[model samples]
Target: MKTLYLDAFSGASGDMFIGALLDLGVDIAQLRTELQKLPVHGYTLTADRVAKSAIYGTSFDVVLDHGEKDHGFIEHHHAHGAGDHQAHHGRHLHEIVDLITASDLSATVKRHAIAIFNDIGAAESRVHNVPLAEVHFHEVGALDSIVDIVGSCICLDLLHVDRVKCSTIADGSGFIEVAHGKMPVPVPAVAQMLSDRAIPVQQHPEVHTELLTPTGLGIIKEFVTEFGPLDAQSAVQQVGYGFGKRETGQFNALRAMILTTSQSQKQTAVGHDQVTLLETNLDDQTAEGLSFAQEQLLAAGALDVYFTPIQMKKNRPGVQLSVLVPPVDRDRFVTLMLKDTTAKGVRYTTFERTVMQRRFETVTYQGLPIRLKVATYQDIRRVTPEFEDCKVAAQKLDVSLETVMAAATALAR
Candidate 1:
């Protein structure tokens, strides 16, 4: 099968991702024609080979026609300079989903686009604690992000890529002021998205700016299977670079490479990522307190959490708390661990972990929500519903949890 690997040497954004794919030989005219199927209007497509920091690559853009009156183009408010020419861009998650569903795009392309948008919506929902459908994509719901997403999908379909892998993602540090006041760099949605997955990431040492956008991370999360450098077994077929808007450094570009992979490599490439492992010892905390602490750690962007039984100093039985997290989220989670538990200190280490590429599907049982998860390996494929979703259905049906789980399992099968 064919494979595509992304090299985010500097950072990534919606424009950079699409631009790189265009440089990888996706026909520009055909991409424009495919995007025209969307119900959105008042925007013109633009593509060119641009240079940043002396590096050259294709730059893709969706130039909004704010002057047009036919598509209800109202003057958008850019309170913090994010709305200057970016007017009427904010739309709810459900609205965008319905728009894509109504478009003339192919069913396969539509599914890929919606799945990406769902990822972004899920991240926003977690960051704001709002319903998935109710999350307003203030920055990503705009015309360019919409085009970037759909156009990327169309190009990938045309290229016939079967798998995707990426290098360690690079992001910036410090604060970024946007439409919703000043937020920490990387943005809450981007940070939350990185936390939810096993994608390896690092902070850009020089620039304190918004390097990776929420839309960009969402796309990466949906398609990228493994995180790290590509293996030497695959033969590279093509190479392309997508330059970002910034010209501060040579790392301000994303590189894409097409490769021919052997079957053995595909089976072994499912999940490989770098993460930080944090541990602490606690003896005085109650069971209820530990449960709440775990929930808070998850919300604060922990990858995994668990406890182990151990004998502390003086023969006292205690629990050893373990937290798996991304390096970018180390400080925040560490603070929570120190504050929430009686432990005055913590121990941590960084290592690489491999996991299977997972997919999520939501099914409804008599108006109750049930989520199905699919995983891939060498020859084994696993499908199961999220336990929490099954629990809720069980309560609604007044049935045993195991019975509800089995019913959901049968439906998934």
Candidate 2:
């Protein structure tokens, strides 16, 4: 198993992330070839060594050709009237999408890049009250942003990590200026992008400035799977620094760590597991209501949800609702269950389970084909239905949910 750990001690920015990856040895030539796919009239990728506090590091820069508007705009945008005027060479979200689709990159790479942009666009849209397509990306729509995004995707592809995990961002306090003008720290756009992801900004004396920008926030918002304190035992293969422009009392840099693990562990084989299983029994709820609650819990990011028939005290009938969630999400998920269910108290346990490599095969039940994911840990095979597919099949065939799930489970074996 392989993993990438992001340490946003100094915070993250679009360019800093790209520079760190480039410094980490991703092929710049290949990245440039892909960037050319965007329909920008003219542009060039430049990589060079830059110094931060006497530490020489690689800095990635984008030089774009503005054609006629180059003169006035360059003069207007530059700090002083030294260079030619520059054009608003910034691109629209649609243009970025077109560039991504037109690039001759692998399908996986393209999908990843597109998904990243979608995440950013969704955030910008939500904040501005505009449609995603109509949203004009501010800092992230620029040439540098496009390069950062495409380049980050390429770097991830090169590393070929199975999963990416992040730690709670140490987003510093204070306000920062942007295209929309100066706003509160951790700008609204960034807040919206991280609506679902957990990146708590803790107060640290050594930290200041808006360390996490919307672009960088959007990247993690879409790709990260889990968030918490870094596990000290995780094996680290390499560590790279993504530097931001802020200088706080503490060293500021986004630490990117590549993890080393066996291939089987990457998928589902678990050598050691410590997971929280939350359970509650309710006898007064209908099967349909339990089903709806389960759906909502999973959608809220619970790892798994299930129901078990049980005989309560005095032989009372009840359904035990169990939800498995990552430690970070436990509080939120538990609150959701409490609000949605009639259970007065929920019981939880931390247990260990050995996991193994398991594969699933497509099977047909009642003329509907379904795919099942089989997870094996310590020779115990746990099979589960592809519920979304089962739901679809049940609706199409006009069959009960149980009938579809049973058929799908049987075929999976």
Best by TM-score: 1
Off by over 4 Å in 2: 50-56, 66-88, 203-208, 246-250, 262-413
Relative to the unseen true structure, what is the C-alpha lDDT of residue 267 in candidate 2, on a scale of 0 to 100? 45
Instruction: Residues 40-126, candidate 2: write the lDDT tens digits.
Output: 546667777676767755666566665221110011122423451322554467877888888677787788788888777777677
Writing each residue's lDDT as its tens digit, candidate 1 over 158-210 gives 87675688999888888876656678977887888878668877887687787
Error of 1 at 317 (Å): 65
What RMSD, rounded to one decimal, does every model reach? 19.3, 15.9
So what's the TM-score on candidate 2?
Answer: 0.57
| lDDT scores of the candidates, listed in order | 0.77, 0.69
